[model samples]
Target: MRSFLLLSGLFCSLLSFAQTDTLPVFPETPPLLEDVLQDAEEEVDFDFDTYYEPLEALREHPLDLNRADREQLQEIRLLNDLQIEAFLEYRATAGPLLALYELQVIPGFDLPTIRRLLPYVSLRSSLDDFHVPLPRMLSAGKNELYLRWSRTLESSRGFLLAGDTSVSGRFLGDPNKWYTRFKHSYENRLSYGFTAEKDAGEEFFRGSNPQGFDFYSAHLFARNLSRTVKAVALGDFTASFGQGLILYSGFGYGKSAATMEVKRSGRVLRPFTSVNEASFYRGAAATLAFGPLEATVLGSYRRRDGNVVVSTDTTETQDLPAITLSSILNSGLHRTPAEIADEGAFHQLTFGGCLRYSSDRFAFGLNGVLDRLDQPISRTPQPYNRFYFNGNQLWNGSLDYTYRLKNLLFFGETAVDPNGRLATLNGLLAGLDRKVDVSLLQRWYSHEFQSLNGFPFAETNGVNNEAGVYLGAEIRPASRWRLNAYYDLYRHPWLRFRTDAPSRGRDWLVRLTYYQKRKLEVYLQVRRESKEQNATDYFGPLDRLVAHQTLQARL
Candidate 1:
């Protein structure tokens, strides 16, 4: 036991010595805190002037073709204001310049000036180079392509319930949908493909078609036009006319059919309201721009076929021809010689108007024929007048002013027999006349028509008096931000057809949006609506409120 203890002590001593030998050996030295502090102080006093002076001098020096605003570019050696303005304007409309050589494209920016400016100008910054190359190359032969996809969910509720039926009971609605777009471009031209949409909501209304996968739009065009005019032609397409006054054929308005159902004593009481097929118009259209004066003319034909009753009822077919013309005139005071030379902007008081005419088959009006074959019916073809106007005609005119202060824009219009609530007209004729036929109007009606037409029944005509004013102002405080807003008021002379009674309402909408970067955006909106009537036993008070928040990104 004694011998073993001696051996253990020797082994412990050997381990300690080995551990000590493994450690690093160094000379003893004092801390250098003083030296470090001195070095930091020297750095604090170093001359930033060496870096800032060059930048200041560069800023003070006027830029030539590549790095200058209109005025500064004009001051450079041989260039004039007109040439400078033209160059800057072109650049502004085009985009961030990619190379100094592009300056030669500007009028009066000759090769010599471009060469002189090259040393002082840079097409890219260090940060810009760090990002992915723009006009991203997609393939060796094909131009770069960009694709985007988005999804949204929305819910809405309305204020009034007209009957004890399901649609009249609660106004709860939800829609979930997705969208995808693909685009490819070369030079000044582009080609695009789009689709991707879905609908999920209550059965009473048709949500958007799952399209599930329908090609919504596929087209190719040159966005930048040749010298005097701009134009586009479509092979097969959809379009809108003058705020949709005459024709508006697009997808998804009536994806869901509005319906009403009632049940009593555990038995189905009433069948669903008639399900009207969604409307789609196939056509081609274009706009012509001579200058400040522009015009758009469109013509389209549509057909709708559907059953009035169950599978046994015979189908009804209808055809419609729609046409519209819109024109704008502007004074030529500030126009360039090219504008005046081109005979585009004429020197005259500014005015404009639009005319839209549609044959009867164009719109979806209420069908009076009942599905029961044995029932008695009136045979007057339900007064089939394609043009249902409470007043005289279907023409609209407006007077406009373009002032020098930021080229302020002011316009007002009045329409004769404004077709729907969408039309805006000007003048004393814009008021509603109580004696006019209240039965032919489609959108908003006075209480008299509602009572006369009966609950849950759809009618075309109503009170036609509608007048409103629109004023707009746009100001950009920064390069990446803008603001705009508008207000509208509408009035009906008769409240529920009470002679000498009037009801009025107002709608307000405001929006603000910000472009945080080239591909990112954020926006906020507020909307409010109010009606002039108090609650009646038949219908609730009329009022509505809505608010929206949105963020969008593109890549």
Candidate 2:
């Protein structure tokens, strides 16, 4: 990881010193982004591009604070609802902002928050939403192209025998990994881009991949094109509705050191520009606004890679055997013959819509989504997998609400599967003082509930068979010092993989940070987690669950 960071730093230095004036100069990567990447280093399928591309786009076309609406502000993801409400109220009473430093007067917008927003916002008011000519919108946009490649310097055994077809476990292609991206953006209104990638050991421009790259994604997104149409997306995209129970794709926020920023907030529709192959829809989606009410509808059809199981009957006379999917794979890798065999094993069709009404003090949303597959999915049955969804079709509907009363903001979502099982999440954010803010969240998801694309804040990877309460607080004790902490207590009501019975857990985290004027910054974080898992030393046929604890601290 250190070497990788050094290489990235060197590359950025070269770009920064280049003679080309057209190249955009990006600000330093935010600490929040670095923390997210470091936390997920253990995840084999994690892609850094999924999170970096949006910030890059924001730098290229910074948001106009005077003209950006509530939805656009929320997409920034740096401000909480309380802060947003405060900013909007301030703007309503004070007129358009004359200077960026005026944010210091807002109740919840502290110096730290203002500093974070400096890179992504501008005080100048841009063009009106209406009467924008198409030719100018296209010709005035910024165009960018990026190409990157990486390969291991050491000679591994597999790469040494690259062309040995008779040898087992030999690499089918070279060790080079390649990536390319091209984008055009017209300020904050329009964006279009395409991303292509080829993983190491994957054939390029030959054999399995004659198309040059293993994966390709492209999208065209426009915002505020008309009074009725707030946003529209064509090609690849992602959708997120209230609390992410019905539909959520792309990057997500979860439990982290930034305790107060836990809520899921973003635009209802966003263009897909990441290299992640399976997490986005590949069709079209649109959002329409009328007064205070808004409507969003989307439809998508795409191929999915899955582990296919063929019928074992030998007496069948047919040339091809009946096949069923055992599981879906999201690694987006096709380096080996076995991995290649699972490519595009099935096709999926998805359609969904959301209806929302928003005002100064209240908001409500109704979301519905349905997914259908060309082939049936039947996982190998196990005690832990009994409640998993299996079939050709699945549907879910949810209702989410948010209300603001003075200094407190309340939000929650309730969803139901076709079987009538329920999943719910609710939370509250309160500003007790100018320098103190706190948050509370609770969730209950039945074991029978299932979601394919939903990503929520929880201890477990999936949002089922769990109930928990989380309490978080942030405080500025002094001029340059801040304190953050959170505690979560959760329980799984049903059997999980490797566990024979119900289990419970608790997590605690505390972080202290100090920031000095433009010269020095430091932070210390300590975290402890205790959970139940099967005992490793048990000699009995059926292992017993035992408590396990782990502690970590970093500075």
Candidate 3:
């Protein structure tokens, strides 16, 4: 009965709070690394950059500081958001916190964010999800097994037509590129695993993968459960709300050197152990809590591998000839025969939901998503895709926010596309003193903003025809001297892909360091960028239109 009237209105709002008020015990978020999902696969065009399975699941699950949260303290990108709200307002006005030298008297806690939370937080004590024992959480905690294999020592004519048994340019498989993983965890409540991969000219267990790793993933994550179902997932998952537009299947990091890490922290639901086969979302997702309102729900059905385009125009009452989908084969490589005839052709069904309301410094969220596709998406006729997105369905809606006062802080997200186009992202992180810090960001996507799982916080890498402005800074002044910088200015009005007009860009970064106290360190860095392209199609005599500049160095 509607989850029993939402658990009897969450037990009458937990009997109107005050059962000696207590809440804010979070921890159990580990599994992220590839320099942290490499800026959302930097506009994916990969040739290779392995993501060692979430750094072996954070080297076997780590992240616990009086149970962390704030998206696991913003994935230790080295505290921002005013030093994670001065270490949670100094552990909620003094209580629980014994050493780490009481964060040298909080207030924008520094010392390089306590030396990056001393290798993933601790000061333990916060493990009691009441009588855990799923066979002692599966024989007391951790277990891992991973394997990798690769090939490509030059020999591609489809691996020489797979040993040439004729069939010109053959290649129905075999070139070796396999990976396997198995994980098991406990102490964050529990997690299950499985992952397998193969893609080096596909074919593994024979012709077009006769069931033998052509990509496979599995998962089971649980947390708190009966404590008001605070988390749950079964079989591949990922979800992100806010600052990511509608649904954001995690992956981030941009303009690095940890300058406020350009916000977009996740964990509205997680566990999709990356192998990036068209960015996770296999099935089921959940999170529920009513003490400060939090409710997340998700559903997914996968089968996405592209290429199925047909359109010769004619359909005003069947005369056949109108099937679409041209583009979307996210390199899950399927070894030639025209990429094994487009692998899993296309079938995606997603439905997501979120509604949040956090406390202690405010927060709010409302996200929605819907995507259905089973052959229908015609593209090929451009002027920068004249407002893309065709048939087979797409829907998105969002409204996100966060706030703080006292050394200031704020965050934002706004999305819409019921075919009315819109996208927005906002930020500010100030704390200018106690050494210094500053950050500000603004984004406005909308060249017909569309999202089939957004990734907001951009400079192109997919978040839709850009519009940007960002500024950042950090300075230590002493105490092992430090400095950081950032700058971004962008525009991409339309035409993309080998650009041909409507473009503008700029990027800058600087880092300088010199630490000592955990055994010396030194650093120096620089970067530069500029864009607006499409040059050298070999035409000079009075030719025109071109621009480029890229540079980076360190010492």
Best model number under lDDT: 2
- Would you list the C-alpha lDDT of every candidate in the order shown? 0.27, 0.82, 0.71
Give the C-alpha miss distance for residue 239 in model 1, angstroms. 4.9
Q: Model 2 off-target regions past 4 Å?
A: 2-21, 41-62, 154-170, 314-320
Residue 478 shift from truth in candidate 1, angstroms: 14
Comparing 1 and 2 by lDDT, which wins? Answer: 2
Total clashing pairs in model 3:
2
Models ranked on lDDT: 2, 3, 1
What 10-residue stretch in candidate 2 is worst by lDDT?
9-18
Please, what are the lDDT tens digits per residue for candidate 2 over residues 123-205? 86666756887666655666667677777667578777767777666667778878877777676678787989898888999
Writing each residue's lDDT as its tens digit, candidate 3 over 328-400 gives: 7776777777766777888899988988998988888888899999888777877777676777888888889
User: Candidate 3 has what TM-score?
Assistant: 0.33
Please list the Cα RMSD from the true structure of every candidate, rounded to 1 decimal place. Answer: 27.4, 3.4, 22.3
Error of 1 at 168 (Å): 17
Model 2 misses residue 288 by how many Å? 0.9
Please list the residue runs of candidate 3 whose C-alpha ends up more than 4 Å from where it truly belongs after superposition. Answer: 1-98, 102-109, 112-127, 130-231, 234-248, 256-282, 285-299, 302-318, 326-373, 376-378, 381-477, 485-507, 511-528, 532-545, 548-555
